[model samples]
Target chain A: MTPIELRCCGQGGQGVIMTGMVVGKAAAIYEDRHATLVQSFGPEARGSTCSAQVMISDAPVPFPYVRHADILVAFSQSAYDKFVAELKPGATLIYESDLLSLDNRLPQGVVARGIGATRIATEVLGRRIVTNMVMLGFLVKQTGIVSKEAAIEALRTLVPPGTSAFNIKAFETGYQQPPE
Target chain B: MTKREAQPLRTGLHFMNGNEACAEGAIAAGCRFVAGYPITPSTEVVEHLARRFPRIGGMFIQMEDEIASSICFQGAVWAGHKAMTVTSGPGLSLMMEHIGFAAMTETPSVFINVQRAGPSTGLPTAAAQGDIMQVRWGSHGDYAIIALCPSSPQECFDLTIEAFNLAERYRCPTFLMMDETVGHMMGKVRIPDAADLTVEPRRNTTRAPGDYQPYATYDGSDVPEMTRAGDGHAIHVTGLTHNEKGYPDMSFAVHDALVRRLQRKVHTHTSELFRLEADGLDDADVVVVAFGITAGIAAYAVTQARALGRRVGLLRLITLWPFDEARIRTLTANARAVIVAEMNLGQVCLQVSRAVQGRIPVHHIGNPGGPVIEPEEILAAIEGAAT
Candidate 1:
């Protein structure tokens, strides 16, 4: 199978890099595949544009960065506007519904899905910081590029001490969201 | 004189960044002291060592500056410890004088330069292969140094160990030349068991104190056996022209012999020091030469060119210094042309040209530094070379 390329973009501190790390770890450590993650590094502080690129394959990933993403994940309006055009045709574009008002303009054969990740984290998980967890769960549900068990195993190994339970719960809630 | 029990190495598959893996490699290779000032891209290496040293039996000092950090590790080496310092381009510039100091004193130590774009602090967080030439010629005077370039997190872990071993074996400064992309990118690295690892033991003198000469080799080898301070041996270490006693002789003959030996110790070992990874070279028309992160990009492009039915191959340089001119000449003898792909405009590319000796056309595909060279860009170069 062709390797799956992904780009996750958002403001710094929104766990954009962490989202990529989780999937990379899941594919590399849990699923016994090759994965490479490269994050954008800059002088930007909290609210600036931050992104992470991840490539997963059965063979070793030669080019570390994603050139044209098979999946584009945007957590804010600016991120969606910036990265949506780079998605391959028939690629999936996932975004946070509450943060973006999509103009409904997408590349050819692109599929768009929006989840209220922030609302779900705040309302269901009682913590807005778990928003990336919600999106990660939904990403696994929609793409199935990485197995759900592998992702949860990655989250359990990577998250801070005593925070895995809450983050996994946030992830499950997003995973169970009905198709709209 | 009681020996401490060996600490267990972290053996197994691990998902980590290149810098973190380098730190683990250092520990596994018996590096117990690190003196470094924090710098971007390379800071995580010392950071990981700082957190790890306390738990194990070692020391990590945040020195006043890169100069202090560089020479400070040399001091640790003299005091009987395997030590190292980590930094990027700008910090590496500050450490040049001490790098010369280590060379002069025959210090067995490792210096890791996770290169960033620079004439001076050009890009702190961006990747570059700009320092390929500097690590060899940065320090003043005519002394040879060993430098290794690693393309992935796994090689980062493995080559860091090899760097330390080369330093120990040759009794000279060795370098792990990493760039921002390989240093920051995360991948899976498998560390082997401690028993399975081959570590070169430090060559210390067994001669009695009164009979021991600090710079004199008992055998025909140019490398002298070493003895740490307070090891019941009278020893002198300095940068000025010195004799077998390591004292300042300040004579032309003494200086010539000392300098020649310093260069010969590593220069004569070129066969053992040079490392190159050849892929699909047996049946290829064009060969791509690259190192560090650019090697990975070039390898991907080679695969693409193969699908297009071009007989292109890859020659990845794992060892940068003691440039493998002989191997490059032999490997590309059958090829139509050689293309050098790197992040810097033209550093190692020139070396390849010199090795090829106008036997075939040599082309370079590079940029000013920072943004990575895409696979498509390298693929285009392969096509150009093939035709």
Candidate 2:
């Protein structure tokens, strides 16, 4: 792939930074590519909006910051609203359908798709915290930026021990969801 | 000691952030003592050290404040441990007195300053190269220091080991001046096995207990031999100007000779510590001098400028302190202009200007702190310098 800049944003406790870390590790460590991850350094502990920027490339990534995101993965209405303006024209946006109500006033030429990630995690996986991993599964299937094997391997190392099976099931459920 | 016996930590490829990589580098270099209070950006270094030190028979202490943290590491050094302290701008400010003390006593230690926006608690969450000058002159007096800047996570791991090696080799304090961006950013790092690394052992005095003079150099070397506190050597370490006995000597001659030796030890041996990355300097009309994060940006700008048929090159300073004057003078002597790009307001630019000495036009592109300098802005500077 050429260089791709992605931003995953959400509220403080929504695992936005962890999603970025998994994707970056998948690319840099497992896929034999280059990736750089930088997170927002704001007061994120107070449940404020936070983001993590991940840049993936076949070569070394020169700059770590995301000036304009090619792909934006938002998990909340506030995150989508705040970051919608920074997406490049014709950019792809993946968001949680249960959390965000899509507005018709999105930036011109932007392609947005929604998945009920939180619903799948809670109802099917019996956990609400696995929504980010569910979204990561959907992200891998939708964007094709990282291979499924690489993503799954990255998830194994990133998640807590003995819980990888549950998270992988949540991810597969999200990946099998139809586009809305 | 034999090279095989010096190996300490296992090495492998890992995806880690710069701060964690720095902590691993210290462990691989056999650093056994670390003391620091948590701060923004730099807190991860201490966090990683706290977790790993216990496993390796090392000590990690979260001191009450940066003042105590700074001196605590020096005390550990005197007790025959390779010591380090990690902090940000505010904590670095508080550690200045101890840094000066370390310099005066010729204490072998390392200080990792993950710089943030500041004059006084400025943007704590953002990155900045504002502490470049402070690391060189923040501590009072005329003593010289060794400072290294890393541009990437791999360099963060590699240069940190080099920082500890330089500290032990010279028996002086060394600074690993990293910025918030490089400290917190994540990238791929490949760590070589300890057997593949050349670790510098401390220059301990070989003389018998009664014959040892702590500050005396017997072999015409400027660097003095060190002895630990419990080594049965009658060593007296003081911040005051002392003679070869390591005691306070008030005479002007003693003070002059001592101070000169302290500065000369680093100054005369700068070639041993000098490190930089240069590109396209053979026939370039414009040169960009940058360090740390700005160097990565400037390097990209140089490549872009070259593609546009402009004769631009980059002089990235990996070692910042004993400022590479000889190389800078030679590289910029015949160039049309030189551009110094940093996050601070022309701090290193002043050094570049002095090195150029009216031989070429020196332009500065700087930000006070916070936001990073974009590559397009550096390209503009390169084009302008070409004109």
Judging by DockQ against the true structure, name the best candidate: 1
Q: What is each candidate's fraction of native interface contacts (fnat)?
A: 0.82, 0.72
Q: Each model's DockQ?
A: 0.78, 0.66
lDDT of 1: 0.89
Q: What value does DockQ give for candidate 1?
A: 0.78
What are the lDDT scores of the predictions, listed in order? 0.89, 0.88
Query: Considering only chain A, what is the TM-score of each predicted structure?
Result: 0.95, 0.94
List, residue by residue over A1-180, the lDDT tens digit for candidate 2. 447999999998888888898899999999989999988776873488899999999898867777678999999999989888888998889998889987865778988889988888888888999999989989888987788899999989999999999989987887888768
Among these predicted structures, which one has the highest TM-score?
1
Off by over 4 Å in 2: A44-46, A85-91, A101-111, B1-10
Cα TM-score of candidate 1: 0.96
